[model samples]
Target chain A: MKTAKISNPSIVLQLDGLTKKIGGKAIVDGLSFDIAKGEVVGLLGPNGAGKTTTMRMIVGLIGMTSGDVRICGQSVRTNFEQAISHVGGIIENPEFYPYMTGYDNLMQYKRMTAGVTEARIAEVTRLVGMQDALGKRVKAYSLGMRQRLGIAQALLHEPKLLILDEPTNGLDPAGIREMREYLKQIAEAEGIAILVSSHLLSEIELMCSRIVVIQEGKLVTIRSLGESETPTQKLLSISLQVGNAERAQELINLMEDITIARADALTNRITLQLRQDQIPGLVGKLSTAGVEIYRIEEVRETLEEEFMKLTGGNRIA
Target chain B: MRNFTGLLVNEWLKLSKKRSFFVAYAILAVVFGILAYAFYELSPDGLNSTVDFATGTIMLQAAGQLVPVLAVLAAAGSVTQEHRYGTIKFLLIRAQSRNKILASKYIISVVYTLTLVLTAAVLAVVAGYIVYGGGAGESTWSDFLTNIASLAVYSIVFVTMTFMIGILTKSNGASIGVGIFSMMVGSLLVMLLSRYTITKYLLFSNTDLSVYNGEGPPIEGMTMAFSIVILLVYMALFLSVSFAVFKKRDIA
Candidate 1:
């Protein structure tokens, strides 16, 4: 796949060596990435992996110890007003005055920025599907509604980049799915860049076009879901059902480039890791060795397993 | 300048929507009504006392003493509520700088306090006329103007003090505690310390500016000009500390 160049004018957010240190330890170390216009990027990391810290630094909620963040070509440190005007974000929970209506909450944000008209407010309310609930006080709304209102407020000014920290947090499965659909619609319809941090991997896999993974404050990998690479192209664990599990395990030990990931004796099933192309050859060898194979299936890796493997078995919070 | 105005408007909108904001005015109305009734019972003849209870000057004097506590409550909540509700993050993320946001909150708080004071003063005057059956006092219009001006200055000092406490503590309870302590116990503390030369410069002592209207200074040898200068100094100090702390600290 072709990587977008640095000179790409569509880049809305660029972080060059962003770093943050607290109490003489680096919480986010030398992090760098760029988000293009109309791109939806997911920030995937375990708890305390510095996703929120990076988001905070981007939004200027906290000072960066080193490096810089540029939004729409304006430096956050030097041109805070101009740079921040081009960006909108919710750092953690999207909090508002509970006594105020959703419209009033949006109005509060509206008054702070320039060129945000009543029409724009109405447009965003409709965009978030919050038009009917705008009159209701925020305290009466559910968490999903609040999140939608928060998105409406963020988009009122038509910012080039939108940053959301755990936008799907505390959401039920249906609510999470709804939020994912809305986010995709916003990104595509408005041509706005979005940077979302979340622990829900399947949601991230479905919602994000690209993913940036970090572990221990360092960049683990950055992958694009849009690429055509199949799951078989990457290392995979395959589960095998056989007539004789013990004999199959011994036969598998004789095979090159294959190792037992897990073994189940009573069920006569074994999980092995190898290249996908070698599965057929392994089966053939096992049958020749008189170990009858009942079933052979590729065990697709869930995002959880891949994340745990990348982070050395650390769970994503 | 537009952003600052917008911030001020936003703060006012939020405050106006709260039940506490209107309840405060309601409390002021009740206090004024009681004061009017008490004055009517004490001077039924309306001619025995040299001081005319019906004049705006008297109203200013009454509110000057009582309304600062209300100002303290309002000003303390201005900053502390945002911190308590974790809503400061929303404001901090805007294009406005921290200082600009804080300045807007501070100025709106002062304006809200002044509005409360003016409303109470007006209520008192109206009640006074209905009870005492007099239109004006023996004092000149200039004396009444000075009284109003001095009351404004005095109330602002308390507002600024409470605002500083709110920013420093970022907790509604702590801000209210300090504000109430300063309003209630402050005078007693100043009275106990009045023997010392520094007592003349204490904030509570300088805050009662009715001395210019012949109400007598809280301390001996304290002039109106001296008290004005002291209050201005303290106001500047409080504002400077508030801005410095707010600007330097990170929003949690």
Candidate 2:
């Protein structure tokens, strides 16, 4: 609905020590992160881990107790209208006037957003594949239809930053996939920075290029899914087929920080977990001990396993 | 200023399409229609009533009753319904300031009340013509205008209080409860306290400006100018609190 020339083109949103306190207790504590253009970042936490609170602060639904959220280089506290003009978001569930038609609901938002043309309304509805349902009242819409309409309105403004809390809350597998595709497509084609939060680890793994994990209202870790390495995430899975699987595993027992994930006697195969930098040493020691190494390949750990390790097995709801 | 008008248009469209609001207007229409029939059938030859029957019916019908209830429902919905449907999350996040949004809702609620009044005024005139046969009891347009102006002042006073309740309670049931309770008991309190000096300063006692031109003040000393100042003071108090709280409070 509004456009401003970004002085900082790369970073669309910046959270500097964002914190929110209620009743003398902190709900979100010292959280900091940055989202760049054409990037999809996920906020992963337990059910009450302040993910929703952080999203609210960014979109100005909830006032921050201390710290600030800067969107497109404008401070939310000092310049709210200019800062929020570049954002489009749905905090939890996308709610609208149920008695009104979907088209009328969209028109309500359109009228408040300056410079939005009627043609853009058509374009957004088409983009969400909701042209047929536009005439029907919103009460008749299924949850999935409302989610799509939510996305349509968020994109109607052509915002520089998009924030969604649990974007795939009630969608079926296929619908979730469709939402992911739409988000990725919008991010790439329109240069929009997107932030989606969910408690489902595997869901975040499949959708986001990077994830910011928070537990107990504090930053735990930030990891990139794009082949970037961090010390805490250096664990790797190695599968090797040798002449004697048991003997090869026994030989690697002397190596520190090495453990067997699985072993097969019939096929002479052993699956080992170790650090990425220690792979060559493990293979060298196994081959020098009169063992024939037929094949070795690295297997990536499932993101669920990594998330569990990072969050320390907090119940994700 | 343009942004404020745009918000007003949005509120008007939403309220007009609302079933509850539309039903309120429908009831108003039916009530006026029935009252016209009753006035005609009960009197055989024309009563030749001196009062402007059209204007009198509007004030007597709406003084502290239907108009206030309808206006309160509409006003309360501006806050409570938004929270109920979870639409306030989206509304509060817009580029417009919360002050502007609150101001728009205030004006729209008043506009809604005035529109209801205008409809009843028109219907009352028709009823006046049909029952009186346009011979004697028919009011001059100026008298009709004066009565409408008086009703407008009363509407402002009632609506300001109702909207302030909406802001304070932030719950549909609670706002309606307080609005109804106050309007219902306002006159009773005034009557009971009429013997005391403090009754002259009571809000309800000063609200009925029609006392100046018609029945005179129930309290001995209240004048038209004094009532205007009192109304302005209360409006300022209610509106300042609304803007201050709305601008700073968390929407979550």
Candidate 3:
């Protein structure tokens, strides 16, 4: 996969060596990342892994103990009003005046973002599929509807940088898919930089072009889709035509190049990862020994597996 | 300055959206209406006590006074409500300076207090005038209205003071409880102390609007000019303390 070089291209948001300490503990430790225009970056971390903290700093919600945040190359601490003018966000859960109609809530947000017009409000409501419920009070809406309205509110000004923290949280599978697709469309079509943080690995894999994984308040790895080669490991599923599955599996387990595990043997299949060279050797050895060779296929590690490996299986439920 | 005005409009809209505002208005209307009727029944004559009855009832009935308490309640919970609802982070993240946000809320809380208090005052005056056959083409009520304006400033001052305390405490229960208790209980405590000693500075000692009536010795050895200065100094102290504390608090 090819990678784009940084050549002074416009950066909509950047966090340089950001750190925050709360209750004498480091919540965000020397975190750094950047989002250029038209880029969608996923922030992946455990439940307590500082993704929210980083998002807060970028939006100027929480002042960093050290380091700096720049929106559209403007320092938040120095030119807060100017910097924040280009950014829009929804942190954690989107709260509204529960007694007011959804339209009134949107109007309130529009009032916050300068130059927001009724046409723009209508456009955003349509974008988030909330046009029909605009007249209903927010208290009457479901969580999914409220989340969509939150996104609509965030997009009211067509912000240059959009930050959403765990946006798909509490959404059903369909809602999650809808949110991911909507976010990708806006980021790509509108040339808006998006930074979304989530605990769901598969959701990030599906939406983001580049993924930043943070663990225990430190960045572990930054992976771009199809850029870095997945660790040179593949799961192989081998099946035998004859009903000598137990004996064959035992013999294969003795091999040094692979770790064989017993798979449900309705078809007498064994699953394991083997070296590329070991595959040719094993096939020859099996044929020569008169073992039935039904099929040999490699299963690539999914983003979920890679996430487990990168996070060392420290995910929270 | 335009940005500040825009923010003020937003804050005013938020205040109007709250149920407490309407509740406060309803209670004020009912209480003032009842007091208007009672004043007419107890006036010196059947139909000749228009201006006097209006002025007497406004002073006698605590009905309209609830506006200030409601104003304090509104100010007490305004910012703290955002903190509890986890929207302070969202609010602070917007393209507004911290001072602008504080100032907007401070101004809006005062405006809210003034609007409610003025409504109550109008109702009391109108009801009294109607029940007692109206003030007989006199300039006395006009001068009294001017006096009411000065008293209105005091109500505004108390509302702003309560707002600052609310922001400083960042807890609705604590701010509201302390604000009301200080207004009510602190006045009682000061009055008690004044009976035994030389210090006679009670909170309500300054709240009496008729001090300019030239009736009794001033409550705290404070002249009108000195009293206004003390109120200004008190406002500055509370506002500065609120800003200092809020600037240090961690956004939720």
Best by DockQ: 1
The DockQ assigned to candidate 1 is: 0.70
Best by TM-score: 2
Q: Write the per-residue lDDT of candidate 2 for residues A1-317, one digit (tens) a residue.
A: 32343446698898888999999889999998889998999998877888998999999888998988889888887788888889999888889899999999999888788988899999999998999999999999999999999998898878999999988888888888888899989998899999999766777887789999898789999989856554744787889999988888788888899898899989998888888788788878977898999898878777778877988887643
lDDT of 2 by residue, B1-252 (tens): 677788999888878877676788777778777777877678644345424567667774442246666776777677778888888888877788888888888888888888877876777777777767566665566666777776777766767776776666678788777777776788789999999978877787877676787788888888999988888887788788877777777876
Give interface RMSD, every candidate, in order.
Answer: 1.1, 1.0, 1.7
TM-score of each: 0.88, 0.88, 0.86
lDDT string, candidate 3, A1-317, tens digits: 11222335688877778899988888899988788899989998777888887888888777889878878777887788888988888888887877788998777667776788999988898888898999998889999998998898788877999999989889999999999999989987899999998878788888889999898788899878655443445445443343456666766777887777556567777776675657777777667677777777666567888988888887652
Residues A1-317, model 1: lDDT tens digits? 11233587889999989998889988899999999999999998989888988998898888899988988888888788888999888777788899999999999999999999999999999888899999999999998898888888888888989999999888889888988998898899989999999988888888889989997788999878746575765777789999989989988898888889999999999998898788889988987889988888878766778778888777543
User: What TM-score does chain B alone reach in each candidate, compared with the true chain B?
Assistant: 0.88, 0.91, 0.86
List of clashing residue pairs for candidate 3: none
The models' CA-based lDDT, in order, is 0.82, 0.81, 0.75
Of candidate 3 chain A, the 10-residue stretch with the lowest lDDT total is: A1-10
Candidate 1 docking quality: incorrect, acceptable, medium or high: medium
DockQ for candidate 2, C-alpha atoms:
0.66
